[model samples]
Target: MTSPASSKRPLWIVAATLLLGAAALWGGSRLVWSAQQRDGGVRGMLLETQTGAQHSGALVPLAVLAVAGVAGAVATGGWPRRVLGVVLAVAGLWACWIAVDGVSFSGFPPGAPVWQMFLGRALTLLAGILVLLGGLIATKRAGAMPRLGARYAAPSVKKTARDPDTELWEALSEGEDPTDSA
Candidate 1:
């Protein structure tokens, strides 16, 4: 007996989840997290901003993990997908830790919107959560997941009902024509 869920694997959802997480991580890298006044320049004349990647080296790795996970999930199934899931979960946790523990308030000058400085970390945290979600799904449902090109697999050849060499020879010896049996 098979249910709908068992027969169907929503690969698109998994793919979308991974893609969203990756996009968020990449976006986090581009967001300005900290700003500082330029050295040797007029006061407040120029401000240099640091993005998530500049703030912490961990973000890049997390992003890379998400990217790789997408490919792995699409290309693999069963135990391999489960292992990828574990990796994504661990990487997500590490990213969350980096975002929360790596906070520094020293870069922004006075009168700057202090709350805005956390934008990058927020993005990182969100990305981590999304990746973790995708990982958990992959881990728990990997057995049912389908690998790429599974639908295009070749059909197996079927066996003939009777062996011509064995059955035909036997029938001939018995004075029964094999062609008549067919």
Candidate 2:
């Protein structure tokens, strides 16, 4: 028998995964853009700083996360989905760490002011945490998908027609009031 809740699980997972992916993309693009705004360009400004390297490394993990999210949206069950979920979660954690470190490192220069550095770091940290949590939830939902899919994948139950309407009609025919305000 397919329970209504179980049947809806796949749709929910797909929707959640897609939403997470879209959010990550938006946040990531904004982070990169902000860094570019500070440095003037995406490719030329980051070779001299530790934060640059960390931020650069974030791209790969972000790619992995995007791919995994897309995959989860497209395919909700099986081992591939499980593997992707784990990868997405790990990537999310790594991204968070990089953001935190980058934010801290940005303030340690002779040119950069302390307030601006701290503010950038705080924003990065907040975004990182959001991405991390979203990825983690995506992972958890992926884990639940297989169980839900398996449960609902079972053969459907053929219910007998012992419906309330039929019973009511039979009661009325027998001179008994079916709707006696009971």
Candidate 3:
């Protein structure tokens, strides 16, 4: 007995999850790559220092959180969905923190392009907020909503086209006990 509203919730959740995940991935990559190319020659190109030591950024954790958020959205049952919501919210908060830290650089270094830094941080912050909102919505609706898989399940085919005798025989052949009474 799935309602239209109930089915639509999961679809919204899935869409939000995907959008947030993509934003996080893109922003985090930009931040990390921008940092790596900060000291490069001509328009922040990495050609001059391609063999230089690479600096690791917050991209890894951000990616992990995005993956978890998506997994949680796809998971079955209330508890799992709620847990995933919490995870996504936390990830969003973490992304916000990283963005803030990046933007808080005291001195603007010549090597580091200000525009890229701000753009990356801004995207991360926006993505984090969106993800957080999505997570909260998921958490609130999870208890009352049907599992994502169950909601999309195909309806059972009616056997109105079959004769009663044939149906009974088919049922019995499928290991339904004939002597069993309801």
Top TM-score model? 1
Ranking under lDDT, best-scoring first?
Answer: 1, 3, 2
The local distance difference test score of model 3 is 0.60
- The order of the candidates by TM-score, greatest first, is 1, 3, 2
lDDT per residue for candidate 2 within 38-144, as digits (tens), equals 35485644423323224455544474455556556455565666566566666656655655653434434344344543444454445455445555555555545
What is candidate 3's lDDT per residue for 1-182, written digit by digit as tens? 77878766764775466476556655555553233334455555552221001223555566666665666676655788888777777766766665565345545444656565566667766766766776676677776655657845654774452777887785675678756778
Measured against the true structure, the TM-scores of the candidates, in listed sequence, are: 0.70, 0.46, 0.62
Candidate 1 contains a number of clashing pairs equal to 0
Which ten residues in a row are the worst by lDDT in model 2? Answer: 29-38
Model 3 quality (TM-score): 0.62
lDDT of 1 by residue, 1-182 (tens): 66656645555566777778888888887777777766655563566677778888778778877888888988998898999988888877777776677578675675554566677778788888888888888888887777887766653653343766986775565578789735
Clashes of each: 0, 0, 0
Clashing pairs in 1: none
Clash count, predicted structure 3: 0
- Stretches > 4 Å off in candidate 2: 1-54, 60-64, 105-127, 138-182
Task: Report the C-alpha displacement of residue 114, candidate 2, in angstroms.
Answer: 7.2
Which pairs, if any, clash in model 2? none
